[model samples]
Target chain A: MVEAHSKIISFASYIPENYVPIDDFAAPADMPSKLDLNRITGLEGHRRSKENEGTLELALQAATKCIERSKVDVADIDLVINCAVGSLCSELRSKLSPSLANLIAEKLGIKGAECFDVSNACSGMVTSLMIADSMIKTGQINYALIVAGEHITALVDEARTNNLWFKSKALASLTLGDGSGAYLIGKSELPNQLVFSEPFTLARFNKLCVGEASKNRPGPMMRTKAAQLQQGVMGNLGEFFIRSMKYMDLDWEAIDHVYSHPTSPRAVKKGAGIAENTVGKIKRLHNESQDIANTASTSHCMLLEKSVQLNQLKSGESVILVSFGSGVAMLAMHFYLPEGIEQWS
Target chain B: MVVVRAWKSSSEKTTNLLKTICNLTQNLLSENGISFDDIGVIIHAGVYRRNFRTEPAFATHIQGDLKLKCGPVTQESNHCFSFDVSDGSCSPYVALNVASHMLRIKPEKYCLITIGDERPNKQSNWPYQPITCVMLVALEGAGYQLTGTNFDSSAFDSSTYVEMIFDSAKSANVIGESSSAAQINSDNSKFSGDTNWLSGRHIHAFLSQFTEGTTNTHEIIDQSGKTVTATWV
Candidate 1:
């Protein structure tokens, strides 16, 4: 029987130094700026990578910080899972082999850790969390490091210069920022551990947001049915919460904080409204996308880190994390924080 | 004990990864008298994808294609979890290890693991033939039960491995097999296709020689020189 549990010991995020404002997005060559992207997406600005800062470098920074804060020796780490959707290097080259997890483990001097990559769009970090939790519970491994480094703003550049399909497809690209997040998970018998987690994919909406290599220039391109994607996710907002809450045998009142994917300010507000109607009023909801933009897989962790820095979270307080990805994948996790999480920051 | 309920394989030269995976999954479910709702989790383990596409996991596409409980999970809805686990050719064993733990913890009756890879695009270089395999695993079954598994990896800096590289002339990212990769290949078992699916083929061979009250042990080395050893009794 699986009797053990896993708790997040420490976490860290790395945002590049280059910050780009919303107004900097030029109108597509073929069309005028009819839509106020800042007003529509609720993003003031997002961070971009400086030269020589790619997914690998960003991930290394975040992972190193996470390991240092964890206070766990590097040799004791048993597994490394890289969940970066944009696995691009500083050279704008794609990395598909040897696994980024292997590279990160090599850089960290952690030998013999089982390494792999998980791809679940934006839900990747949480998905990897579930996997790590399972392994810990089943006594497979003692400690696991799950990391994501997204240098995806290259898609924004692709969206800006695109002459065709700017509004319908490339609009969501502008709401992106380059960032990375890493979490160190270890076995814990303490009550303040991951209680329950569930991840689902409403795959029917897979085509709503598609990313591929740019045809017009170098780098990547993304086309998103922003409005429709929001609709599909919102349509089931109530169900996602209810089911996850039920599995954990808890209700909205039991949760101390709610951290949602920071896709956009408007969307976060809209989702809160929908949740309020079905799942009762949330005690506290953290929305941090206005500054960092959508950091893809790292959004939830970034929010957690922010809340820790602000000293808004206390030890043993229950929290809920909500996330969605391009596969129309959704994840909900109910967990309790450990002692001194703020000091880890 | 976690056991293999059934299995399916494909080597069709089709670039449509989702379509191929959907067909195999449907057939596996129907032949086993299982409904799509009976599945609680789906894990896709593939390395090379068309166009080096990264978002929206291929496993989700399989679930969506088959319409496997494709709705928001309410109190009454049967939810299916889907994601991809990419580990070069060691994906199948890694996924199997993950499934074993999940079946012990969750109440799910079955888990599906699928693997295959195709040339990213025509402009990119591909050294192997396209191949895919899907395995249905369950906690209570009458097939090979996974008893134990182990993994060991050499130093990444010194290991000779196959990896993806950006091709400037082709203007695309393609699979780049290092010169030392061939040297490692010489020590591996020769299959018709590339080494990515060697673990899948290894397990398939183990199943072919299954015997009652007997134990089987095998090891496979991935392109990155990670060795996975599995014991079935």
Candidate 2:
């Protein structure tokens, strides 16, 4: 009914109540300055969902908050999509029916909406956004609920049992935490447009990072070639950023905020810095990801939610959201706050 | 509008699956006179390995392996966004629905879906053993039309295909074929005892309606113990 761009009507994010201070990490005694872990990874503490908490609960919690704040009638939600890294149902026996999206919609009491899940590793949320954006711009549905609940801490906890340091090659999975995020996107006019959303596949380096469950492990485990991943991100970050900004007709100065989806590793943080430098000075930086750690698919949305909570965004200001993940793929999108709209938590 | 072009592959390793997916997708596009530049998005659907490989989203490899290098004519616009839709056999159906809306959205001219997977070794309800199959579904206007789709969410049935369908008769109109051309559908229906029924039978059966394949349908009882026929045409 409005402009073709999908304007975010509401945002909500949640980190589990259980807190895991970096000091609590099961690092070896000689694990080289446990206190410096925060300095190295830009994380002081992170949250981890308890055993009783399933991925679906994390998603439901976040979605509840989003729908409450969105104030939109449940019947009006035309789509529900889950872009999480892992399955919400821990036990995916044989049946794959009743998708996560449908489950979420049912929980939220939103019927008659198309439902599905799109998994794209860390960049899944935005990728889902791109998909919803396409559908919305085409007049398929007005309101699309996109959410992701990640228990990446499961990967870290798995490593902690034995050889975590050796397996991750020294402090991998340090910045990962448990969290979920939700966004309600709808059509809006020009000044409130969702500018450019692009995802480019760089699969040559897909092997650098992978998530899987081994024969002995029942949950997701991440094995990464940390060095190689950093090298790849850094080598391509600057060039891609400049070209993207130029293509979007945006100046680094015009962007009121840069929500760089940091992966929580020191090398990645450095690469992020290099990425920012290549784009000149970002007007304001949303780096809460350091404290929250990396939440995989939900990281970018978490960053945006935190910015809204802190009132870092304003109406009509330019913002850039960037995500790079397991697919060795990168999604960059530009958007501005709608007129007269205030940040909502 | 429907399954204008299709390809199927079967393999054990993820690498082979990706290879098969890439080949099948490219073949479909080329056969349809579609270029890499014409596609704005690629939707991939399938489960990870038996254990569920979560990271490095497989679509990345599938997209990367395509090697869509920029041509001299257009360097800026050739890039297409690719992502994965994971849920099991139901993923391709959902991906196609998402693609339908996306294609109708201007700027997205074509949608390519690549699906393939092998049955996990330990699943008890698997009707077919060591089954792996791949299919490339490309949809564009003025082609075969996807009438609609339905899923028996009541439960998962190994012997039945009941998710998405292309009913030749249900479609409002047919381009150069008979009113009943080919209809392909998938769902977790009852898994008939036939080994061939588990993998790519829907594709073959649907194609048989128009081409040179045999038509075979099986009726198997579902989790509810009700007999439901899994058909191909």
Best prediction by TM-score: 1
**Predictions' DockQ, in order:** 0.59, 0.24
Q: Residue-wise lDDT of candidate 2 within A223-305, one digit each (tens)? A: 77777877777777777787777766778777787777777646555755776688776667777665678888888777777
Clashing pairs in 1: none
Q: For each candidate, what is the lDDT?
A: 0.77, 0.61
lDDT of 1 by residue, B84-182 (tens): 887666677778877776665456888988877766678765656656678899987787787877776772433454545667776665656564333
TM-score of each: 0.93, 0.79
Q: Where is model 1 more than 4 Å wrong at Cα?
A: A26-33, A164-167, B104-106, B155-166, B181-213
- Candidate whose DockQ is highest: 1
Worst 10 residues of 1 chain A by lDDT: A26-35
